[model samples]
Target: MATLEIKEVAKRYGDRTVLHDINLTLASGEFLSLLGPSGCGKTTLLRIIAGFEHPDGGQVRVDGQDITALPANRRQMGMVFQAYSLFPNMTAEENVRFGLRVRKVDAAEQSRRVLELLELVGLANHAAKYPHQLSGGQQQRVALARALAIRPSLLLLDEPLSALDAKVRVQLREEIRRIQRETGITTVFVTHDQEEALSISDRVAVMYEGRMVQVGAPAAIYQEPTHPFVAQFIGISSRLPARVVDADQGVITVLDRALHTPRARGLQPDVALHLYLRPEGVQLQAVNGKDPQSAVLQGTVRESTFFGAVTRLRVELDGGQGVLADLSTHEALQLPIGIRVHVSWQPDAMRLLPAELPI
Candidate 1:
């Protein structure tokens, strides 16, 4: 186990800059995930950490030792790529033993380590099978075992589960987390999938166009996103136009209804604002009786979609604005389309941001 640090990292390709002033620190045995959309520089940052690519300007350190100039082979890092890079002619056991053989470990130690890694990845019985005879999931397990056989100080996973089927991806992700915990290895996983990053990481760093937008625990990133980009990108949300009626008092007016909100810095009175509300934050109730503590907006159900235990309803406000509300399937069926309903949410559930902010 070791601590990993990336300080002031920057990368550029010709005139386009992909990474800018990237700085992050990982504690010993911590699992940190780099999450973003395609072309967001997550994979590039991972390559820099693995010593596969040099940063234009920065330092990569492991346990207080500078490794920015170290070559890939001497960095003590193990990388598992998206495609299974197993040798087709090598059996599973031999593939796991190859790393040890490169380092010239004795035959006895190599054999013991191979057995342990195969068992660790739950491929002990298939030790004699070659990559050609194994399933995609099995092949990935072999690759993981091979990466771990050398006992690297850091483990880098570059979208290692993207090519598998949905079921297999979920299963393998859980297995990877289990193995990481068992070995307590410092890991950096790069993925474009938000669910994967949120489900398995101790901390998540959300990136956008060469810059990190937010870094926090999964719940924090989901519940309290500091930037408008983060609130919209991290989850499903409905945006409605609003106005800051009283900035000092943290009051806003939406759809001609006055409501109090949290104070935001740099907000001025009478400025146009955008209110962001998550589906789970919006509540639907019959229009007759209403909750006084919540801010209510009258709307009619436009459509409802059932997704197993949960149902999502699209409600169109009297002003022609649409908002989404999530409810139990049982409850949603009680209210059909065209039925008048009251949409309400807690004051704290809505986020206020400048309307000019892009995305």
Candidate 2:
């Protein structure tokens, strides 16, 4: 229910810079995710926002109030960590009531709030159970209920479901999203899992090495990545060598096969670039189709993997380059091994980025 803003935030540890000019804004009631690989400063940035760690520069504002120098407790933010750090001695209801008690709520109010929160998290029946008596998912639900007991202005989640089993993780993720939407609490989630971020966030900031690489809706970031690092980091895709053959008409040639460029406004001819095409975007053609304007590459099916719902095929181009294709089991059943196939993709599905990347 509050807008969070981080302006030009910088964090450092002695001589090493951990975060550099991280600028982001979260709309009121929006769920924003900070996503990146391990050691990429995603957690460091979350800590800074939570007021657990101070930034060297810039400001942290909540509802237009600068809270840069405020202590973690005074910031009035709720945090849920990867580990369910619940008190072992306290029962579920007692643990959820701790925050209200700390804030000096009356006994009657605390009891009502704790019960409501437990019910909200679907743990009302287990209110009398201790931490050791509950499963990992149940423990995390208790943690969430406790965090909500405070009714803080912002909710910060650092891989809150990472420790749970896969089935529990999926269920808990939906539960968390439902809770957030119902409460309308502004949330900042940090995770290294790309699928988790893409599936749950209203918007995501893709970070790399202490810098924000790209920030956008999941669809935009996945379909039209602006940088090679962003494209490679966000999802599975093939990057093929290409040349700018026509700058005016947005044309690029790959392996002497010309294809229309994907909205490269200022590209120059003979420049080296990369064409990013995802596996799902490529289609297998046994023979030439009627789409004359489309560019197709003939490759031999090198390997195929059957994965129940879908099958994956690896095709080797004439130049020895490889492209991966994913098909449903029914579609894959039509093709066999060592078959020469033409791989075709829509022009708009192609994403272009500079071939040479920094690091």
Candidate 3:
């Protein structure tokens, strides 16, 4: 395992700039994920780290050694792409041994390593099968085994499971995590799948248009997003128009409404603000009941959809504040559709975002 450091990295294609002053430090043996939408330069960043692409500026250091000038093959990095790039003619065992053979490892040691890796990936029995004889998931496992065979210092995965079916993707993702944990190799995984990043990564870097918008644990990024773009991108968070009517004593009044809540003090007053709340944070109650400790929104349930585990309701506030609330199926069993109910949320569940970003 090796520590990976990227400092002031920038990339450009002719006149168009793709990456700008990117800086990150990855701990050794950590499962870090680079997450973003398409064209966000995540793959470009990964290629730069793997020595497949060069940066126009800045440096890349691995294990305290500057490797910005090294070729991809000399960098001792393993890479797995979205497509399983396996040798078509060779059997699984032979394909995995290709790297060892290239380095002139003895036959006895090569056989032992191949058997170990095939067994490690649960492909020992299928070692004789060629790439065309395996399923998508099986082929990917073979690819992973082949990548690990070289004992590379860093493993770079670029959407390695995107080509699999939904069920296979889920299963293979877990398998990949298990393999990574057992091997303890420093890895960098790049993907556009938010759920995959949130579920698998020890730390996630949320990139946007070539810059990292947010970087933190999955829970922190989802619950306490520092940016509006992050709050809107990470999960199902709704933004309502608000203003900081009272910035003293850590209190703020929800503008256009009579609700008051405690917030971070020292924000500009009477300015436009966005109040973020997650779907699960909102609580629904019968119209006859009252909850004084909660901030209430009087709204008729505009639409309700059964989602097996949860029933989602779209509520439109009387003053035009729109929000969505999710109730568990068991909780919504007795409630009917179109029922006018009071929707409320705790004060702490609301997140505040700047009206105009300083950046």
Evaluate residue 121 in candidate 2 and report its C-alpha lDDT on the 0 to 100 scale.
98
Q: Write the per-residue lDDT of candidate 1 for residues 1-359, one digit (tens) a residue.
A: 99999999999999999999899999999999999999999999999999999999999999999999999999988899999999998999999999899999999999999999999999999999999999999999999999999999999999999999999999999999999999999999999998999999999999988888899999899888877777878888898989988777777788998777665435788888788898887888877665455646889999999899999999999999999999899999988999988788865567887777553
Model 2 collision count: 0
Model 2 CA deviation exceeding 4 Å by range: 287-293
Listed per model in order, the count of residue pairs whose N, CA or C atoms clash below 3 Å is 0, 0, 0
Tens-digit lDDT string for candidate 2 (17-96): 98998899999999998999898899999999898899999999999999999999998889999999999999999999
Better of 2 and 3 by lDDT: 2
Candidate 3 residue lDDT tens string, 1-359: 99999999999999988898999999889999999899999999999999989999989999999999999989989899999999999999999999999989999999999999999999999999999999999999999999999899999999999999999999999998899999999989999888889988889998888888889999898888988778878888767877776677565555366565666477788778888889888887767765545545677777788999999888877777778888898877655766777777866567989867633
For each candidate, C-alpha RMSD in Å? 1.8, 1.8, 1.7
lDDT for each candidate structure: 0.91, 0.88, 0.87
Candidate 1, lDDT over the whole model: 0.91
